[model samples]
Target chain A: MNLFKIVTKNMRQRALATTLTGISVALAVALTVAIVHIKRGMQQRFEQSTLGYEMVIGAKGSPLQLVLNTVFNLDISPGNIPWTLVEKLQADRRVKAAVPFSVGDNYRGFRIIGTTGAFGETFGYKLAEGRWFTCSIEALRDAFKEALEHSQERIAKEKGDAPAKPAAHHHNAAEAVIGATVAQETGLRVGQKFIAAHGVEVSPNAEEHTDNPWTITGILAPTGTAVDRGLYINLDSFYHIEGHEVRDAPKDNDPDPGQVSAIALKLRSPIHAFPIYREINDGEEAMAAFPAVEVRKLFAIVGNIDRILLAQAILIGLVAGVAIAVSIYNSMSERRREIAILRALGARRGTIFAIVVLEAVAICAAGAVAGVAGGHLIVMVANAALRHVSGFTVAPLTMEVAELWVVAGSVALGALAGIGPAWRAYRTEVAENLAPTS
Target chain B: MNDAVLSLREVRKSYREADGNRLDVIQVGQFELAAGDQIALVGSSGSGKSTLLNLIAGILLPDAGVVCVNGTDITQLPEAKRDRFRAGNIGYVFQSFNLLQGFTALENVRLGQMFGNGTGDAVELLKKVDLAHRLHHKPRALSVGEQQRVAIARALVNAPALVLADEPTGSLDAANGTAVLELLRQVCTEGRHTLLMVTHDPAVMRHFERVVRLEELR
Candidate 1:
């Protein structure tokens, strides 16, 4: 028989211990695989969600925070820049298209984006159902008129005056084009009215719209990323939903409508982004953030987290290796007579060593298979839970370099674990051993 | 005998005690074994009979000696070559049966032929030991006499140039002991294999063609 078959047969001889060792290795493999896959999955999602964005121009704060708020839609904006300032930026020769986003409201944890219909086209968003907002002043008036006809008409009256001109849109009211995720989450369809409020922390019992209700006119399709969880509306409508009202007593009573959470600037070319970024940051009041750079920094942060976890996995993997070593050592004691018999029959010490090493590798391979399968199982369960609870799909297993690294490392660990025992077996004295055996 | 199967010269062996002093176990000046020869090594306790058997089988390295088996000086061979030489030419029978406890009698016999030049048909070998009906029995399941027979079959299955028996019947009663010795003598003589049996029993010594009485090397 070849060395492998003999080692395997002997492993099966102690059915319980061999199986237990295999399971131990499998558990370690599974845990390491899961951690590695999760880190890669999170990083990949970050990359996918951040693609296509060149740069973000916002009021000066943390440049990273500006990127997070604008590209990922994960955090609040870093205050707001004036519309005139954005207009000035659009006028710049290098600037391609400048879209202003006003964010304040959330349906639940999802963001409500207020921008032009051009935002959809620029971002390449396709509608799962319904159409993008027509960006017409008449459409906004009709939506406000419909909200006035709803059950909470008392609050609708408090919406104050409507937009005056063909260009002007809202004074204290707006319309909402429901995102696919938000619509699916709340079962809100076209013509259904819901009070849109500012911030992700609003209470469930709070008046959804204290003054005006926003009608759901459109729903966007899943982008396979974060956009699925967002809501969109017109910039003027966003101000209206936030209860911004211009009064006749113009002194300090008039709230400034020019204030926005952040401004997102799209340059004509990638090469123009750094120049514009420098230009924006050169002004003391605002900071120009490179969404790509900030996103990489974010990955770096998470990378450190992954590194710590990987170190812990290595530690546990070593412990499992030691357990295999101890098990093999103990078996040596029980099988010394067997070794003596082998020696008497003319088997070399090196052959015995190879047999022992082969046995260890076999156990490791079994464990690695079990661990990888188990790790994916964990990912599947976690993905299902995220989908059910958060309606946000998480990838359980994705083909990536990190996963390959884990598999290769696990096999190497198995080989390393067998080294010590194999060495001991090679050095054993045949004469002394055979002299004591029957 | 046409040629001696085993030859030894001026072999010296010692063991280190707990107090760091070396105890001389054996100081044999010379020994030789011819084909079909059954030589019994007889000695009281601590007389180095088992030690001498190990020296002849190439299992132990003497402090000073030349051990030639099948015309090759095995004493000068490296660890791996010496082991190969031993496996091809030596078989060992122990006092305690020394069968791998986990394997059935058939598997135990199969193990004997594992590194040998040719396979030993375990069924036929077991039948030779009158254990064909009990081939499936584990060492733990076999009685002392049956276990010894399985071990004997295992030792001779490889058809080695020399068979080393260390108190092969030491753990058996007189009835079982005599039966085991007769089988060893019969197999060695019939197969033309050199046999070296270590024993304290005078009756067991009678089956050997020659007898070597060991004494403490002082």
Candidate 2:
């Protein structure tokens, strides 16, 4: 009786064509939704992981490589800069804080970093169990001083022989702080001991540092960042490990005494970041690079891949639109008698036109809704797998403004596809179609 | 002249053959039907009886003529307005029954009422046509006579002043055809609607008070 009921009945009569067209639209929409979700999620994760650090100073090399090694714990570091440079940066008035990192080791494929406790605080890491390591040389020196004072007092009180001299340096190579992912994957609990290999990847020939096995003194809580996949130990302990120190270096060629992979710097004011970056790159000691700038460059390279995927999604959408057009137009031939009946019943040409177009819109709207839901389901599954493999999480069921535009665009395409069929319906001749069949 | 419910003046309609020859389908100098008139238009195949009915219903436009229904000249109006006028004042019943295939008998009648001046109840009209028991039955489920009855109910649901039936009994067997013709004549008489029907069957001519032969009119 009504236009909607009539349209529904007509579609039901040709269920196969309707379903096929709907599925085509759904496929296009799903691809578009998945692409937009992944691209945005990647950008958000990269930007969030780089927060709180203004610049990274490392050995002269690729800035992107330096950032990837220092921030994301991927790829090898360029080389080690002098530990003295970290101290100098810390002493500078323009630098609010400087955290040193020493890399090139892994525990079962998870990177092991030698850093100070300040590094944990700089990256906002919270301990899940036990306490931070006695990792810094200064902390060890203070502990040694306290132990010496206790022995002297005991000697005086007992009227015993003179107290023995305290050792100048004591390396706590036995202690380690493991990240959440490292603890989960390795099944290493507090007080458990493990040996770290000398390289970033696990290979049969990679040498293990068995001379100084490490105990898990603390475990970090999950932060949804690269930190969740790292193992932290004392800088001094890293140096004391066998085969860690370079034996022979020309004094003139390598002026710095100790080595560190990179220094994470926090500026006194954000405005001072570029000035200090220029000063370090211009200096002979090390090179300075901004993490944000390097991440942008990385995305520019990744953008090419994104463009190809987006084009493929758009092509699928266009093909789906054409499928809708062909399906509707084909059905119009069979519907001529029905259209003429409506015309005889006093339906204007515009009414017939509107009915056809509305049918197309209805089909597309249903497909769009299903596609969006399906896209998020895929994202949820992918997020679970990515979190397990890489310790990175992308939230599922997140909708962006661009996705809304995609839905709108699909509806417009459906309407556009309906135009040809609707025009044919509008031009139906009542007299010819209603001629009596002999 | 004012009492005539349907009138035509100098009506002419033609068609072009495939070989570029012109053919005149219907040509009538003048025609008139009084209020409540029940007339039959008789002709053989290709004699343009159906074409004349279509022109009178405003479903087709004449090449040069005026078709006036219910005291208004439909030929002077634009296509859109003509459709509205036909919907409000003229109803049609085709030989094939032309009942929308998927719609129930009640829905088909209701559809006719939707475009009209909205004056009559569809259920009441179906009951008048003795199809109350088959209100929810679709055209395919009904017998041929029952389907024609539903079509009659649909054509009268708008209470139009003029009803055009193009070979209304042409598709039925002898028994069903006679029954449908009798029912149609009784319904139109009771409603005081002017009836114009086209048919080639001589048996169907007896129910009408006046019979117009297309051969003589041309």
Candidate 3:
């Protein structure tokens, strides 16, 4: 019989120990593999969500909060910056494109953002159906002019210095473009209309823009970003809403209409990013945040969590290796006579050593295979759940180079663990063990 | 002397006792066995019969002298070379029939030829031992006599010049012992292989063509 057959037969002789040891190794590997997959998925999602935007300019606050609010739509914005600042940034030669976003409203749980057509173009969003809102400068100017004329006519008719009623004016219908996830969750098709709430929370007493209902002009395709969970409306319509109008006296640098939550800036050249960031942050009106920098800080915190989990996985693998060593060492005592018999039958010390080592390697190899498969299965299930809940999808079963290294390292650990027992088998004296009593 | 298939000269072996004292196990000045000769070595319980068998099989290196098998001194070779030389030239049958437990009778016989210079059919060897019917049976499934028969088949499968049998019938009953001894003699004579066996029973020693007492050899 071949050495492999003999080794396998010996392992089969102690089936319970072999299987238990393999299971320990498998559990360790599965945990490590799953953790790595999740870490990689999160990193990729963070990177993709902030693609193209170099900096976010918003009211002076936490840069990370500004990024979270504007880029990921994860937190409440720290109030708003003047729209005049956005106009000034748009006029700058260093700024390639300055897309303004007006936030602080929601439809269901999804954020409703007021932006121009340039926002969609700048973010590389494609429409699944219908068309983008007709948000040109001409449209905004004409709508503003019509509102001003109606306000004047109302003031003249009421002679007693009363507040101009916006309800009396017949303005153009405000248009809205919905994201793939927003459309799916709300079941709002093109040509349907929905009113916006004043804030993100769903409450019975929350104020709604009942008179300024918006028509769904388009639905964006899935982009696997925060944009996929937002509702987009024209900036002009956003300011015209009842509660959104600027009531305080306008500052010298503030726009006459109102404020925008944040301005997403694309640089003319990547080299100008730092310079422009410094210039914007140095200004009193706004704070500038590099999305990549803020995201890196965020991931550093996440990376610590990953490190702790990775350490636990490594500890588990080491314990599994020890388990294999202990189990094999325990069996060595019982197999002393068998090893002596092999030595008596012309088998060398090296042969016996190789057989024992091969047994350990086989167990680890089998365990690693099962673990990788089990890990991917977990990722697949988690991906489905995450997609359903948050509209964020991570591709499952992606085998990274680090995982391959882990597999190789696990096999090496198995071999190393077997060395002690193999040495014991190698040092077995044939004459002593072959005694009749033994 | 020229035709001697197995020979030993000034071979001595010792072990350290638990009390830090040296104990001489075996010390033989001279020994020789001619090709195809069948002999029994009679010894007491502590006479180091097993140690002598190990020396002849090159399983243990002598503390001081040469163990020559088929004209080559095995003591001069390295441990690895000695193992290879022993596998090719010498065969051994243990007192308790040291057959591998998990392997079938046929496979056990084949295992003997694994490191040998030439391969032989294990089934044919089993047939030579009259164990053809039990070729697929493991050692646990065989009777003492039947297991000994399989061990004898394994020893002869490599076509060695000399076979060492250490208390070959020590565990068998008288009837089974006589049958197994006769089978070993008949096969060795037919195959022209020399047999050196260790035993304490006079009745079993009578089956050999010649006998040597361990006290005299020492």
lDDT score, candidate 3, position B175: 97
Where is the poorest 10-residue window by lDDT in model 3 chain A?
A: A246-255
Model 2 spans > 4 angstroms off: A107-109, A125-134, A139-198, A202-224, A233-243, A246-257, A384-391, A436-438, B1-3, B18-21, B102-107, B113-138, B215-218
Candidate 3 residues A1-438, lDDT tens each?
788888888888889999999898888888888889878886788789899878999999899989988988777898888767888889999888999998878888788898898998887899999999877665555544444444454555667665555444444569999999899888999999999888965567789889889999999998878788899999778766655644343333422444689999988899988888888889898999989899899999989999999999889989999999899988988889989888877788999999999888878877888888877887887886765444466777668888897788789988988899999999988888886452
Angstrom error of the Cα, residue A34, model 1: value is: 3.3
Instruction: Give the per-residue lDDT digits (tens) of candidate 2, residues B1-218.
Output: 47689988889999999999989998998789888999898888989888898888888999998888888999989988887888888889999999888889998888888767567889988998888899999888999999999989888888889999989898899999999899888888998998999888888988777998887665
The TM-score between candidate 3 and the true structure equals: 0.86
C-alpha lDDT (0 to 100) for residue A190 of candidate 3: 99
Write candidate 1's Cα lDDT for A1-438 as tens digits.
345656866798867878888888788778878877766676666677667667777878888888777777766677767555666777888877676677777776677777777677777878877766656445434333333232133333456644333333335335667767778878988877776655654566644656666677778887766677777777666544434331212233322325456666667777887778777778876777777788789879878987897788777777878888888878887677667767676678888888888788888788888888898887787776655443355566565566566667766776777788888777777656764543
Which pairs of residues clash in candidate 1, taking residues 3 or more apart in a chain or in different chains?
Answer: A60-A286, A79-A261, A80-A260, A345-B87, A346-B87, A438-B94
Among the numbered candidates, top DockQ falls to 2
Looking at chain B only, the TM-scores across the models are 0.93, 0.96, 0.97
Docking class of 3: medium
Q: List the candidates' TM-scores in order.
A: 0.80, 0.86, 0.86
- For model 1 chain B, the run of ten residues with the poorest summed lDDT: B209-218
At residue A32, candidate 2 shows an lDDT of: 84
True-vs-predicted CA distance for residue A233, candidate 2, Å: 4.1
